[model samples]
Target: MTAIEIRNLSKSFGAVRAVDDVSFTVEAGTVTGYLGPNGAGKTTTLRSLLGLVTPDSGEALVNGRRYASLDHPLNEVGAVLEATSFHPGRTARDHLRIMTTAAGLPASRPDEALDQVGLADAARKRVGGFSLGMRQRLALAGALLGQPKIFILDEPANGLDPAGIQWLRGFLRHLAHDTGAAVLVSSHVLAEVEQTVDNVVIIAKGRLVRQGTLAELTGNGGGAVRVKTKDDFAPALRAAGAEVEEVEPGLLRVKGLDAEEIGRLALDQRVLLTEVTHERSDLQSVFLELTAEGERA
Candidate 1:
């Protein structure tokens, strides 16, 4: 079953429509990337889902009910929208202890959550002494305190170094794979999301422009066959109904045909081929093209 659902959701701030008829679903046991340019209404949509902002039309549902209708909402959904606030003088353990107590969870949960995020060793250190990466981890630890079934994180990798980002990628995958959690992560880091998420939901001007698995979205754009031959085969390949572009000396990028087809055409044209391979379009380029098109429209 779908863990999170937004149906025809629209929100406005005076004369500005932040989100307009946006709709999407996040399923269990998978990570879905929520992506959009600045001012595209991603934050507004998430805030509406968490009941921090009410939508003007439609609804945001968590497990078939509105977030406000849920019993023990914290235990059902965990969110890390921004760097969590904490008393600078308080130790990490103390901060978590307060949250654990408020959530009515066992005292041991704080320690477990800390260890899960690799912050166990810093439990006794004051929050003021921590770096940005450490604070990001602490916020994530707090989100996991309830062992919630769904995780909604906005820019969770903010302030994380390369190593920290890598760790988060694996941790998020583990949560969805082993624990059957539904994760919706919003970020402007397209490359990281391209590698980490199973599916993607892209928005522009507060409307959903695309939503599908990585393969579905990327693969549909078609692939190009790169070939290197001793002799130029661009003319022959073009005559065979393939779009050919000379990438560099002795190299050609062929579209509307696969590597095998390219090879067969080269052989028929008596071209001595040295290399042939297929390359898929990168997600970053695709994302830019999509958003740019939306802007023009």
Candidate 2:
């Protein structure tokens, strides 16, 4: 099930094109990581989807309808954008209580959400005294007040400690894999994302650069072989119909052939390889490769 869809979405602020013809979908029962560098139109695309910003062209749909057109928006989508703020004097429970009341949700929802986000112990603490990580959890608790099926979170892991981050990883996965919700998390933390996300939507310079499952983006299902050789094996590898890239002066990233095959071919061609290792591309490497300025479309 497609929970969120952005079709040909483009938005401009004066002369700056914040988003340009970017499109992607988030499926139900999966966590999609929306990743990009600073000022890469990630937030703009998300804002457009939440109806916080109107697009110049294209569509941002929630369950096949515009967000504003939904009869009960809060019951369908829960968003925790970067600019989330709370009254300094309000207790965590109070803040959530206010939200539940405003959204016509049950009063018990505040406590339930606080417990869900692990903020039950601090429910009575004023927002001003909470640490950044605690505040982040509080904000998340507010978003959970409606118990919506779709979550749109921006930089959700910011300010979290190592343990908190680890907990968040499991929390998100449980939400999607266990309960069958759809989650879209936008963040620049690549390592954490590599572990937490099922799918990835990457953008660069206001353009959709890549979108696929974690395995597809990372090339983990059938990884390439990285060969370091003093002699030239590029010609032989190419001749054998292998896609070879000289990633460095003497280092080659060879696809379409396994390490054993490459080693045999290298020996037959009299190429002395110093290294022949299968390389599983990580999210950070692939992200940098796709979003690098020189490689942009």
Candidate 3:
């Protein structure tokens, strides 16, 4: 079920290494968030997978073959790399027309794609008139024109409102669940991508920090621990070998303590406990931690 694979893949711009020895696998029927900050070589890596940028060393493969080796590349892997990849003056249908024709899909299939992205109502409108969110949808429609089985989408939710993001999440989930397509949704939006993705591929300075299921990555990730207690609990928590830092008037950040242990200790101390919820490590904290780790190394 592995749909895309990058093995020791690397790319550089003269002396600057944009992507360095990156490797990961994306499986079908899953939505993986390829996450990193700016200039993390995320875009370069995706480009390499699509054969838009040749890796300086190693290989980038799609469905057991390099993108260039695929019998019909568009049908195997569809990509929307960035904004403004569309023709400004052409209608959405016309824009997809060129792409479908290149993919050897029926020119008439553009309508199907347009409809899939909910752009059917605006099919006749010039691309120049579309908002940034609309243009993103159109680009995705273009990528899907051939009914591709894999999607490589970069910053797909940028410029989208809450509703648009919801629509995209549901659409992507549907693509994986219904058609069994594998989706790689790249983004730096922590909370949003954190909610949408099933697994994660995190990179920093062209090096991967972690790649795994959401539970595996965040379940035990160290971050602030939420605690509720009377004011006296602070001193008691410190006595329990946990470094308790007041996060707010009522909440505390207890280091070296998991939520269950903290709760048990609080109960042992006969402290009144009204609420206890562990603050799960979010994408932002994970990114900062990984990036800093890379820097220190």
Candidate 4:
């Protein structure tokens, strides 16, 4: 199912365009990473989808309907757009209980949500004493109170330690792949995003630059190959219409061809192959290349 869709979405402040003709979709049963450098209109696009910002043009739809038009928004969508605020004096469980009351959810939901986010042991602790990571979990617990099918979280790993980050990666995958939810996460952590998400949508200078699976975006889908051979194959590979880059003394990064094709070429050229590996494009490198223009803008 197409859980979230932004079609030609554009938004702007008084003098600056925040999003420009951006379009993308998040399907159910997958995690989609929403990524961009700073001031690249990522937040604006997300805000538009959540109905938090009024766009200049285009539509942001959740389940084919605007957020405001949903019959039961809370039952369909859960969001953590920014840093969550808490009353320092209130305990974690109490905070969620208040949300449940406001949302007309069951009283037991608070405990259930707390447990789901691994906060049951700290349920009675005051918010004032909670660490940043713990507070992040508390915010997530509140979002879970509704048991929604779609989640929209911005920088969800901001305060997590290495272990917490790893746990979150697994948790999100479980939500999307196992529980059949659509998870859209906006974050600057390319490494984690590369490891966690099933698909990616990248924007720059208020425009959509790329959207695809990691393999697709990284050109690892039969697009690049790394080969090591005794013979100097750079000239021959280039003549064969491959873009060859000698990354090191004996290592060649070949594009416009796959490993199988490269191996065949080596055989034809009588080059003894020591290695023929398909190279996955690095997310960090791709991100930098795509957004370099936006960074200067």
Candidate 5:
């Protein structure tokens, strides 16, 4: 079942349209990246889903129902939209305990949530003394207090160091893979999101520009073949209906064919190839291209 759905959702701020006819879905047991350039209406869309902002038209649904209409909202959806707002003097454990109680979860939930986010060791530390990464973990712990089936996070890796980011990636993957949870994470870090999410929804000017699995989105233009030949083979490669460009001396980037085809063509032409590697478009390049196109439109 789809965990999150947005259909023709739009929101306007006076004369400006922050989001326009955005539509997408995030399925269960998957981690979907929600991405866009600044002012692309990503946060506004998320707010609409959470009932923090009312959409001017259309609807945003969670598990087929409006977020505010859910019987047990916290138990059904866990969200960390921004940094955790904690009392400076409050201990991490106390902060989580308060949320656990408010959410109607058991007292033991605070510790479990802390352990889930690897913040157990800092349970007694005052939040004011905690690092930015630790505070992020605390916010995540609060979200997990009810063990929600769906998670919505915005810029989750903002304050995380390299190690924390890696840990978060693994934790999010485990949530979707092992626990059958649905995760929608929004971030500007396309490279990290590419590595972490199963699928992506990219927006620009508040409208969806692309939505698909990583492979489906980046699989266009077939694949590029990087060939290292003993001699210049650009002319021969171009003759074989491939677009060839010399990346470096003796290294040619060939498009419009697979590596095997490139190898066969080179062999047939008596060009000895030292290396032939297939290359796929990374998320960063694809994202930049889509957003840039949207701006030009």
Candidate 6:
């Protein structure tokens, strides 16, 4: 079943259309990435889903019902939309207790949640004294306090270091695998999402550009093809029906053609070959191609 369903969701502010005809579903036991550049309406769309902003038209349903109809919102739909939305003087533990208490969850869960996010050592520290990463972890702990069935995190990696990003990725993956919670993580970092997400919904200029499994969006992802040759056989490689493009100065990325075929073709053309590989598109290139191609058309 879909954990979250957005049906023809659209939102507008005056003459500006923030979200336009966008629709996608997040499934149980999976991480679905919500991707778009800044001002691409990702945050606006997410806010509408959580009832923070009423959409101009269309519907957003969490766990098969509107968010407003839910009895305990925190238990049903947990969110970390803003990392710093806490009282500066409050300790992390106090901040979380207040939040979970408002949602009717046991205030005790706050300490456990903070521990889960690796903040147990700093629980007594005032929130204002926390670093950006600490505050982000606190925000995540707040979102996890009720153990909700689904999570909606807008830029969860914001202010996080590389280690923190990696930690969050693994944490989200475990949440889906261990607890069977659906996760909707929004980010502009395609490379990071490519490492963690199972499905992706890409938006550009308030419109859907691509939505599918990472493999499907990246063209069957059968490992990757890497080709290296010192031979000036670009024309010959092209004529042989190998999908090739310049990666750096001398490297050409080839898809759909294997190393063996490339070597044989170069050999037949009397071209010296240094290397051959099948490593195809990286997530960044795949994302760039998808987004750029959409804009070009």
Tens digits of lDDT, candidate 6, 1-297 = 689999998999999888999999999999999987788889998999999999888899998888988888888888998787888999999998888778888768988998999999999999989988999999999888888989999999999999999999999999988899999999988876778899999887778888999878775444446666666777887888767787765688876577788778877999876776655566677666666665564
Please, what are the lDDT tens digits per residue for candidate 3 over residues 114-190?
A: 88889999998999989999999998887887788999999998888899999998988888878899999888776
State the local distance difference test value for candidate 1: 0.87
Per-residue CA lDDT of candidate 5, range 188-255, in tens? Answer: 77866778899999998888898999888887524788899878788877888999888889888888
Q: Which parts of model 3 are misplaced by more than 4 Å? A: 229-240, 246-252, 263-276, 295-297
TM match of model 3 to true structure: 0.87
> Rank order by TM-score, top first?
4, 1, 5, 3, 2, 6
Candidate with better lDDT, 1 vs 3: 1
Residue 176 in model 4: shift from native, Å? 0.3
**Candidates 1 and 4, the one with greater lDDT:** 1
CA error at residue 70 for candidate 5, angstroms: 1.1
lDDT of 3 at 120: 98
Q: Cα miss at 12, model 6 (Å)?
A: 1.0
Q: After superposition, how far is residue 95 of candidate 6 from its true place, in Å?
A: 1.3
Per residue, candidate 1 scores C-alpha lDDT tens digits across 137-156 of 99899889999999999888
lDDT of 4: 0.87
lDDT of each: 0.87, 0.88, 0.84, 0.87, 0.88, 0.85
Evaluated at residue 116, the lDDT of candidate 2 is 93
What's model 5's lDDT at 190? 89
Check candidate 3 and list the clashing pairs.
none
> How much does candidate 5 score in TM-score?
0.88
- lDDT string for model 2 (1-297, tens) is 579999999999999999999999998999999999888998999999999899999999999999888877778898887634888898989988887877899889999999998999999988888888898888788778888899988888898899998988998898899988899999876887779999999888899888899988887534689999988789999999899999999999999999899988988988899998888767798888878842357
Better of 3 and 6 by TM-score: 3
TM-score versus the correct structure, for each prediction: 0.89, 0.85, 0.87, 0.90, 0.88, 0.84
